[model samples]
Target: MSQANPPGRPLLASALGGLGLLAGMVLIAEGGRRLPPDPPSIAPAQGADHLKAASHAPLHDARPGRSARKVAADLIAPPPLDPSGIERTEPRPPLGELGLAPRPKTPMPRDWRETLLFRPVATSSAVFEAMGRTVAISGTVDIDPDRTCTFDNTDWSCGQRARAAFNAWLRGRALKCFLPPDADRFAIAAPCALGKQDVGAWLVSNGWAMAAPTGIYGKAEMAARNARMGIFGPPQ
Candidate 1:
């Protein structure tokens, strides 16, 4: 028979093995604590690229990686140029170049009815000269300078006497006459006044001149006729 192994020897060997296993476990735990945690897992660039590509894809195509930069550029491009051509218009010619005469100005109606001042020379019982124009007193009948009147069945030159009397009253005084701007140079029927005295009124009132059929001196003429004054009276 073999000699029996020592129990103490076997037990001591098993204790040594247990101590080695414990030391190995402790070393592993300490190493794990000392080491920096595994670096955070890096995200792959493909994930970001996939998102970017998806955003750029067209909605209708459903494809995930197609770029729309060229389509977007075309959508934002400027409009096409206009096709119509510019037309030039001709300028109008001046009146002088066109040989056209200038239109004459028309006088205002108010100006034609204005009153005029003139120094007059008595020409007869109802006519006078002013501004180199002969004017007859309106509203009165002019008596011829050679006219005659009969009183007591005797004829007398009443027209000459009336003219003389009118000249004496005038004494070369200035007169205000209402004459149209286009009055004729000859005997124009203008109503005239000396100071505040109406020449026609004086003539009709004194019976030196006869009142016109449509004149305002009818009352004065009647008074002169009833009084037998001037031509209605005896020659003076």
Candidate 2:
């Protein structure tokens, strides 16, 4: 008989072969898992042509051959203003051209009457200063310096006494009278005052001068007449 193979040796060789076969199968599976995916299929000719035309077409028709700077400027620029609906105003015509009287220049304001101070010298019972250039006290009747009055059946120079009395009362005091700016240096019947005392009222109330018909000193004159004061009474 031929020499028989060892039993353990055969079994060990069989195990080694099986292990090598299993290792080769595992390596093949791993290689398949790591492979790249397949590429996509190509498009049709018509679709490819359409895509090429779109890519070459201009973005805007109004701006031909536009540069990058100009495109950026257009993006940031303000919109143009529309002035079609705005209303335009016309200049006004002059008054003379419209057949109307030229607008009268505003008349310059006239000077206001001003109060003047005067140191008067009595000429008569109701007058101050010279005859023609006198400040005749307003609202009073002038008594002539030569006038006479009869009291207790005795004649007396009443007018002279009245003038003397007026002079004494005045004592060279200043009088204030409202006069026009254009007043002339002539006799003017103007109301006057001496330290808040009305000259005309004082004369009429004291009986040194008679009140005018329309004078405001009627009541004062009546009071003086009733009291028989000043010239109304006997000479004193």
Tens digits of per-residue lDDT for model 1, 34-103:
6457866537967788779889986764488855446666569976756576566896676673475544
Error of 2 at 68 (Å): 99
TM-score of every model versus the real structure: 0.51, 0.50
Q: Estimate the TM-score for candidate 2.
A: 0.50
lDDT of 2 by residue, 182-231 (tens): 44566677777888899999998999998888766777889888998777
Error of 2 at 87 (Å): 75
lDDT of each: 0.81, 0.78
TM-score, cand. 1 vs. native: 0.51
The best candidate by lDDT is 1
Distance from true position, residue 16, model 1, in Å? 99
